[model samples]
Target: MQLRHFQNEFPYLVKALLSAKKAGRLSHSFLIHNDDGKLADDFSISLAQALACTNPLPDGDSCGNCVVCKQLEHRTYSELFTLAPVSKSRQIVIGVDDTIPDTMRWFRSLFHMKSSMAGGIKIGIIYDADCMNDESQNCFLKTLEEPPPSSHVLLVTANPFTLLPTIRSRCQSILLLRNKTSYEDEKIRGIAGIMWELMSSSNKISTAEECAFAMISISDNLEKFAEEKADVKWDRIFEDSKYLEPPAKKRLEKQHEAAISAEYLKMRDSMLSLIHSWSAQAYMLSCGIPRDSIANPELFPRDLNVISSIDPEKAYRMMRKSEDLLQILNWNVDTDLAFREFCMGVEFGK
Candidate 1:
């Protein structure tokens, strides 16, 4: 997609980037973050095109029809080097002493090569950069600190906090609009249903206990879901590596475990965000806000009678509790215990 397509949604950001580029002040390195990975990916490509487009519009956006723009969109440009997690473990590793594709070493070698286009600049994009292991990140850090001339590196991630502070401090940070949690997953929708039941229940103690147990059960199911998805991915990798040495296979198993953990955490974070959004919306309803104005209006209690029964002060307190629950979950606290505490502490109804 071209930069102009995003102008309506990200006017300020698009304008600022184009203005900077026009003035020859664009940053050499950028850290672009967004909860929606696909959006970040598209935006990064658009930004790259804007910087390298041979034909730019009067508004300073890229002419999407240009050869350079088409090459960038297709990721076939000789000067564009891209790296992402391609392993079953979903990690970008510091490769073997010899360069291997998708590894940090290989990416560095390609990026540092003489520009394939005369007097052209190179663009290196590391999608899902947070998946880079510590060693890989450190190896990439050298490129960031002393980058090749006439080059730009874009580090794209949904979780920037996982990157080292040194790496973060070196790049210009661009955070895109975070899309709301998707309820398309049946498991997520089921969890939201349980939360709504807990909020609408009149018997606080009994409902809390029941909801806590249900939440824990669903949480366990989410882990299983992640494992099942990871297994499908690992099966292909395992089949290809059947001839590998035992030690190498063992390392692959460990990486598979990490991939499962990463998958589970992604789902769990979405679940938690939904919980927080529901509580905040409930508080808004209590304060006489229109249901249509709040986030995820369809996710709110549909019964008008139930909506009118919420106590403003109680709902506000519950919203605060949800925020605290989200914060505490980031620590090393026990997941089951945290859910139980959060469910028990929530207040609902008149």
Candidate 2:
């Protein structure tokens, strides 16, 4: 409904803004940090409304009845600039380009326009801020250094380490801690969570978490499955190799199949890497480190019981084997054999 959605943990962030409004201490820039996709996105949108709310509730959130709140909800507010990178297709995509989109145009025309709501703040939300190209970052740096009054720039990132130090130094970072409960690399744990919720329980999931888990499982096993058959390679040159080449005469068709296989294998290896990363993240998290810090704290909050029973070191060894399986399979090995080996060694095959 409003920023209240995050009232539990980071109630202080809102409280800080509200306090600032009372004491007038709002900063020009905020670097909102989190590894979680769900929270960071919501925080950015809520911050936008909170800064621009023309009416207020007693609890310090925007009054839904206000004109500014309506504009934000409908996404028609001119003051809000949500910039991300454009893909090669020039279509807007996340983490691809550096330019805060429309920053230049806003400066050009912004001076002539009146605030949509009286005495409202202009809000700029930049997701995937690390994707800024050199040119785009430079352009953004100009605006960031000379921020317009009554405007707040909230830059959201999962990987702030990859961003320029100059940019990092300029903004005030508000690290959002997530995974305070169970910790694993979010993506990989998500895969495991899907599996646990599905296979570990009889209840059904409407979102197909089971399907996602199976896809990830297959991907994780693919490389090891191929690697175990390192003794074999298929050559389509000889008469006996005709079947290996798939008798279709079209060269493009053959290439297409090869591309599909390549892509599939790459994805599979990614799952393996993700598993290793996730376990490591859990381990780290289990040790009481802030999940807010690392971009890839694969051991953030480990299953300490698993870590104690299996040990983090052993888990890491398992991760390496997963990686090895993925690598060896890429060289053209027997898929089923490699797969079986990995399944046998799931979490080091214990």
Best by lDDT: 1
> lDDT of candidate 2 vs native?
0.57
Give the Cα error of residue 75 in candidate 2, in Å: 1.1
The local distance difference test score of each candidate is: 0.82, 0.57
Q: Which runs of model 1 end up more than 4 angstroms from their true locations?
A: 180-350
TM-score of 2: 0.47
lDDT of 2 by residue, 234-338 (tens): 232233445654455456456545655674555554555554455444444444445554445343334544333334444444444444555555557875566
Q: Please give the range of 10 consecutive residues that has the lowest summed lDDT in model 1.
A: 175-184
Residue pair clashes in candidate 1: none
Error of 2 at 171 (Å): 2.1
Worst 10 residues of 2 by lDDT: 195-204
Q: TM-score for every candidate vs. truth?
A: 0.54, 0.47
RMSD of 1: 12.2
